[model samples]
Target: MANETKKSQKILIVGGGTAGWMAANLFAVHWPDMEICLLESSDIGIIGVGEGSTPHLKFFFDEVGIEESEWMPRCNATYKNGISFVDWSAIPGFNHYFHPFPAQTDDIFTVPAFFSSINARMQGHNANAHPDHYFLETYITAKHCGPIPTENFPFGVAYGYHFDSGLLGQYLAEKAISRGVKRVIGTVTEVILNPRGELASVRLDDDSFLAADFFVDCSGFKSLLLQGALKTRYTSFKENLFNNAAVVMPTPMYGIIPPETKSTALSHGWAWKIPLTTRYGNGYVYSADYITPEQAEMELRQHLGLLESDVTARHLQMKVGRVEKHWEKNCVAVGLAQGFIEPLEATALALSFNTLSAFIKCYEKGGYSNQFEDAFNNEINARFDGVRDYIVCHYKVNQRRDTPYWKDNAANTHVSETLAQIIHFWHRGGDFAKNLYMNNLVGSYQPKSWACLLAGYGVFPPLRSDEHNAPAPSLPDMVQLGDFIRRCGLNFSAHNQLLDHIHRRPA
Candidate 1:
């Protein structure tokens, strides 16, 4: 046992969906010399209809070393600045608010002025009436589907991508291959395990057994490698999330492109309208105990202003949350195999990216030691739990009580400790930090925490700020911001053109 030679590291990835390929590609990119193989069954089909991404997508692209020009057109992705939640406040015609990506703040100058103006706006006076006008998202999307210049915002704007999931998987696979990731095609019919309760190898249906030092479970809902072989326990989040089913559809983009993703609340749960360059990816995420698939589909159509037959729907059901430990034994679960949280705020893809990122850290830091794996598992679980809290907060913060769904949630829901703390601070007019690492920080900043629930849910406090805090901003500075935004000469259409120009440039 003295001076033992190390076992050569090999990573066996099960499945080829977005999660699988993403893990495979990242493994290949990070460890080009390591043996990396991805197994996907040709007979298996992907449920690509339920595809959308959060802004962390840029991180994925950067990590995998894919250029935007190379993947953007290939993925048929659309730039999404942020989600525009409509009618969640229960107010008619005026319930729109944005959760913009974290902007590098000149807090010294901007924060004081912003607070003063928001207070004025709350008081019935339209002081600079268009608060969002100063922000880039609203204006940029309006100008021909462009993104804000990456140079102008050094820290990167909060943005998400709307893409065809299947295509994205394929694109990622190509990237993995280019980086020397081996591909194995077949259905996994059996799993071989060592007495150590770790996966030793996976047997394909064709009778070939492939062995590896480590495994990644990207096998979608079946969790063929992680849960099936390891018997990992999936924690149920139904009480908090409630929504367990989805009816998804991909319809052609009818007209002008919408720059933002739209989530509208219904009696049962909520429906999402994600506009890609080519089509609108629509889905109704709801609780089956509350509404039938038929009812959910009907509701989605009504929300989209369509008739029943106007849209074809596919039904999907899933429990919220993932195994208590995403990494156990020698295998790790990525994508749906890890867990799902009903796609609210588009955290699934981001979570998948994070899962790979965590594994990379483990692989690089300590060559997959128990210490690293335990830390990775703990961090991943914390992120999902934090997101769960945020999503639940949306339901809890709603002013809607007309429907049984809304009423039940309002009366019986419990908010998470982290969210409760953030809310408490928000009530006192404090800005949420970008670096709150509940488990590990989900995003560098808490972008979701910045959104004004006060404005979105019609919770106008008696006073915007009590006396004796910071001196009320002088009127001149407030006017300057509004004037600066108006005269900033930021043209979104030009930004769109820049992306197109980048795409067209000879690579």
Candidate 2:
């Protein structure tokens, strides 16, 4: 267990945003002595409009030693328990539900029964369909505020946050600087490589050479470092998943904001309503081939009940795959430089965090060891593939046939092999009891896959009694369950009050 004279390695991180700063901060926090430097082009703007996040963020905070109070206010943070879906199937009836975070019970695993009951109600089998009355998602959305629920879990139940992505970048940059990370403000003019098929350094716009033993790419969609400099071929996920273009806008709140992000399916695509502490983050993710950006933006505006402004419309395009090899000779791509699946669920940031965590875990054990690289690449692939399957399940499971977009896209969509098998398995009344041997197996040991994709998309077991061995009892009504959830806790504040809270707090 002798340490190889640990080389004081230098790391150069490209770009600035949640990904860049998060990488910079992670490196600075874990390897304070290493020469960790971040290069950001002041002229290049970031797509900081992604305000919603998954609950794994709390773990990310713990890793970087960031206190909630300190960064929360500065970043316009708001607690998020889960996401609610409306009109995803485009059914005429009142079909709406939520996918809550990982919730467990000591006495039971009631997830299947819950879904079965709801599905029965939807299918008109059960007269009294009260499936999700006991869940926190139904309760929290009713209250509109996100005070921690007094659940059985003592360590605190799962929760994410809605925050200003730009402010988060600044906050992490400051923290990284405080921890001895050098910040170089300049655009990368050129990439210098060595004869060993490795990146040597990058030249800044000021004609300065910044050398490093390792490079981390956070250059958003441009993929400047890993893809551009290293020439790593990009893998296409267009066939596996659809819906590429997104029209994003940050608008003022319409009324009392909900603690959960709302993803309502539309004629052409889908719209997202993420409630930050200050304002509402809105977007419409649609296939550009099917709907124009202007039309998508217009749909988003109509949904939010607002008009276009300076921050009203920004278009984003992405393919749903990552590089074949995240780590080649000496550089690793993180964030969008790595890959992006459209945000049906808010997972972009969480994926970034896990990618960085894998890098740090590898480096911490042994710097740039091939063992670590293989393992990291495998983990990254698993995470992305698992997510890809889950997202694919959403489109396939939906019964929506309202518009040409949903109809043609869903019907003609080329599903991945994994998703096709999963769909077949579900149609045949398969339970989630079996193991998933796929590369992306839904995180370390958790069942977030079921909680998010299956439940969110309304995929249920054919038998309601599969969840428990005993005879199934009559469940409460949907309205009664909704009322019970409202009584429990989960509320949001008025937009003005939430904004005031953000302004008064210090970073």
**lDDT of candidate 1 over 75-148, digit per residue (tens):** 77777776777677665534766555544432433444555554554453334422353454554554544555
Q: Please provide TM-scores, in order, for all candidate models, with all chains considered together.
A: 0.87, 0.86
lDDT, residue 487, model 1: 41
Best by TM-score: 1
Model 2 per-residue lDDT tens digits across residues 1-507: 123333557888988878988998888877777888888988998886778888778889998888787888888777777778788754333367677765542113244445445444333343332323446545545555563544533433477888888898888889888988898889998899988878898988889899988889999888988899889888877876678889887777556657788889887778888887668888888888887888888778778776644454778886678887787767889889898887887888989999989888886777445457777888888888768777776776776877876667678557777666655544443234243434334343344345344544445433343445544445535575555445444333333455456557675
Q: Candidate 1, residue 375: CA error in Å? A: 1.5
> What residue pairs are clashing in model 2?
130-476, 139-485, 140-490, 143-491, 144-491, 144-492, 145-491, 145-492, 382-439, 382-440
